[model samples]
Target: MATLDIKLKKANKVYKEGELVKGVICVDAGRSEIAHQGITLIMDGSVNLQLSAKSVGLFEAFYSSLKPLQLINYSLDIAKPGKLPSGRTEIPFEVPLKPKGNKELYETYHGVFVNIQYSLKAEMKRPLLAKDLQKSCEFIVEYSNKDAKEKALSKPVQFTISPETLTNVKEKQNVPKFKVKGKLETAVLCITKPLKGELVVEQCDTPIKSIEIQLVRVETCGCAEGYAKDATEIQNIQIADGNVCRGIPIPIFMIFPRLFTCPTLSTNNFKVDFEINIVIVFQDNHLVTENFPIKLTRF
Candidate 1:
């Protein structure tokens, strides 16, 4: 029997556009030399999109033509037909990180309906009667430093949420009277850092049950005929569990989850965006929400 594995130069296996991805393919054969036909290494980067159940029937035509968008594809022959010596063997490989033709590379993101990934696969061709050996390893792609630096200069955003300022309220007379003020350190945030800010409850006629911050992912996928856009909750954090002090500020802090999140992206075939939701739940079970669209960078 034989075994195969891949090891990257960087322990984290993360890279940026235009960088070189270097790694080694390891093969272990018990005590006997293993026969092989040929060895090949392939690099692939793509974006896969799927329609949510809610939008199934609405985009039937679009779904039929949906396919994974290829950003990069490269293959190399690392070894010719040969037999591996007993024990262990390691073959080094280097592949350039570049997009195919005019296609642009997007940051690797793992979402419910959309996924962007990059991986390296090694294939070992075996004899006619022997089974072929295959191994795959995934790597992460991030935005360049230049893009991050440009977005870091954006100004901070301040906000105030009150019953009077609430929108889309059908029954305003039944709503509790309250005024909350807060400021986001910056609307343009770096994905590597935590989201920072603070909020204070100025006044409220009813007791509060909880105050929560919700991180949402907005994904849109489709063609010109129409696009199905969905906003799903990535995570929810309760900053205040009980009725908090009316004047004291409650610090707002949240860490962006890796893989589950990436720098906000938009393209012709699909789009990935993020938002923040401030939810105030009243002891009576009533709730009010304030939404804010945020931009994420890799700085």
Candidate 2:
């Protein structure tokens, strides 16, 4: 009953690119001593795009091995070939979390058909006729530039867009034109910080029912040709349940999740983008929407 496990030195399993990741590999030979080859620790990071066999055409199937993708596999020696003495032993190792030659690394993300992952793996190389021990730990990696953040945040995101700009409201219909004004403290937002802003509605002919701020994510894959979008309401401030006049300013603020959400990023083959969508619903079932694109980063 041989087992292997990975433990990180930091409490949080988050790291930046070009940083050193330190951890320990715990190997336990339950109730018996074991003899085997050397132990190795691997740092593997890659962007994997998987295609179903049934969906592949004849030409694609013939050249399946040449699919476009990026991969990095770096191995470090942990111990020499020897026999294990006891029940449990710990080996400390540190490796740089960097791709070859200053290449940009996209934030870790897992999607339905596409995925970018970085993992720290440990393996016990046993001789032939025996199963080897293996363990893996996944971590999050974010790219950040303080200089870029400063430049992005130097100016506020101010825009006045009519809901009809990108809305489905019929122009022929007598739906009144609504104007939405948005102002954010900074155009650049930090992942661990809360986004603070105010939205004002004016020139509204219909009764305002609800105002909501939505966080939208756009995922692009396959050389920016294939894409998927998802949106969720992050902040909602009800002005009036039934009907109300305009001219009142509504406050909006939402904090991004510490985990499971990546910063805005772009790469050659994959990218993640974020935006703020302002929606105003009227009492007569009329909708006015505005999209304000913003930059999200970790600084």
Scored by TM-score, the top model is 1
Off by over 4 Å in 1: 146-149
| Superposition-based RMSD of candidate 1 using all C-alpha atoms, in angstroms | 1.6
TM-score between candidate 1 and the true structure? 0.95
Give all TM-scores, in the order shown: 0.95, 0.75
User: What TM-score does structure 2 among the candidates reach?
Assistant: 0.75
Clashing pairs in model 2, backbone N/Cα/C closer than 3 A: none
Candidate 2 Cα lDDT to native = 0.70
Query: Which lDDT tens digits does candidate 2 get at residues 75-194?
Result: 998999998866998888999877756565667766533467889889899989879998999988776573233333545777685745655656635667777776888767877788
What lDDT would candidate 1 get against the real structure? Answer: 0.91
